[model samples]
Target: MERTGRMETITYDCIREAAARLKGAAHRTPVMTSRTLNKQSGREIYLKCEQFQRGGAFKFRGAYNTISRMTEEEKQRGVLAYSSGNHAQGVALAARLSGVPAVICIPTDAPPVKLAATRETYGAEVLTFDRLTTDREAFGRQVAEERGLTIVPPFDHPHIIAGAGTVALELLEEVPDLDAVITPIGGGGLLSGTSIAAHGWNPKIRVFGAEPKLAADTYRSLQEGKRVSIDPPSTVADGLRATTPGVLTFPILQSHVENVVLVTEEEIEDAIRFALLRLKTVIEPSAAVALAAVRKGALPRDCRKVGVILSGGNIDPSLLAQLWEREATKI
Candidate 1:
């Protein structure tokens, strides 16, 4: 695997290899269907339930795939990463399983449950940064260079993108005739990977992304024909708050993704409530973006079958309660 610098060229073969690497290690999460949802959306909807993934997110696939391929010396030296929540736990758990030490740099405001899971349950050394005040990427690089630790970024890396693609690979394999696929976008890894996999399976398969209107950098980037950066996002969907699309992931998106649908914070919360009350599942606001798009008729009326990747279910209970309580006042 040669790199052209910090990025490597990813191909469908890379994704297939990632799927092979994750065969026994990662769970083959279930694909769920809701009759009520299908009736409401007027489409056959298949939900890829990644909330049941080992780290409670799809991020574990990329983390484990990347860590498992590290050289002996690199493994001995360990790894470093910066993530708000899900990716932190993904890297920590993967490093732990590989018998490699890890240091994760996280935002001070990341969800308490996710933060505690990474540090306490996974037993990784945790570092905190003020997201508003610190350049976390630069800090991670300095720490990695000083300690000789490999940096496993949340997204951007070819391996991470390839691993994330396996989610769509599994979905398309299960439902071969999906008219389109929609996934929540943060740094664009999931959507990028999904685009590759869906097209590889069937070039006609439409790939779309769900983004918070508050942090729709990828959406704007796609419209502008270049990557666009937005101000630090204050969306309730913490995992979808990436300010910009990944350089590596952006190109793939430009070529492969059909388009991105933007949903408001209220829509995100409504989808979350729907998942909890109607689907009997708990999905975080980030994951609910896809569902919001579906329920709100973001897809074309002709599109009959849609596959949605429920990215994760790691929301804080208190936050969820507060959001629901605030919504109840309006009703």
Candidate 2:
């Protein structure tokens, strides 16, 4: 696919069209405020708690919106997708809801909790690949061809981008005067979509994206002024492990996003702990990227009213306990 260049020109009409398509399918996830967070950060924090979203992540919003628009023939043919975690659950649940059979291609090394959830909960067929040697996109395409399944890409589709945009729609509705908004980026679906919605509502609203430094594809892409691929992503944040940003999303991000900040594994761990201890939320490492950005001063301190999208809360309990133990040892 050819890269989209300078996406700031993306009009509100496109976003409105996406909003209309996503109506009733996507949840209007709530904007939650924490007085404790407010006191500590010294900023009024509005958390777009997408942890409460269907399939436990905001990915479902885009998945459903995209699949729901598919033709009846397409539905009968079913859908195929590749994801390590959140997007797997999103595609699975979306296909289930749309009454279509779904196949998810996942890394063999994917977290047991996420893989099990994708298969058992959503009733999707799971195909595992050796992360060390297998090419997921190629494998996914093969599966789609063999099974006559329409590929619902994790990001890159216009409908998917629009669907993802609804998160910011709901957030802006609840907190109209947000000084800035921060979200985690993988393939740039959520970041691009949210940036479009945020800028549509208020052009001055600062839009930032956070990434794990271990797998900072989007950050590198932004710096290079083009999409870049990370051949071997090594990050605890499974949801942010996409090798490259989508062509469509990259252009949108290049124009609208204020910055793409990278956070180290340690900072990510600290942010996860902060979410668990202070916010009382079990956020996945991917979701912790935004909070980590805030703690690292990646976001502007002058922004009094800030909105952070807690992308998901599907951490494995065993891993959670282990993370807590590690934190305890450091103290």
lDDT of each: 0.93, 0.86
Which tens-of-lDDT digit does each residue in 75-129 have in candidate 1?
9999999999999999999999999999999999999999999999999999999
Give the root-mean-square deviation of each candidate in angstroms. 1.5, 2.6
Q: What is the lDDT of candidate 2?
A: 0.86
Superposed model 1: Cα runs more than 4 Å off: 1-7, 327-331
Clashing residue pairs in all predictions, respectively, total 0, 0
The residue pairs in collision within model 2 are none
Score every model by TM-score: 0.97, 0.93
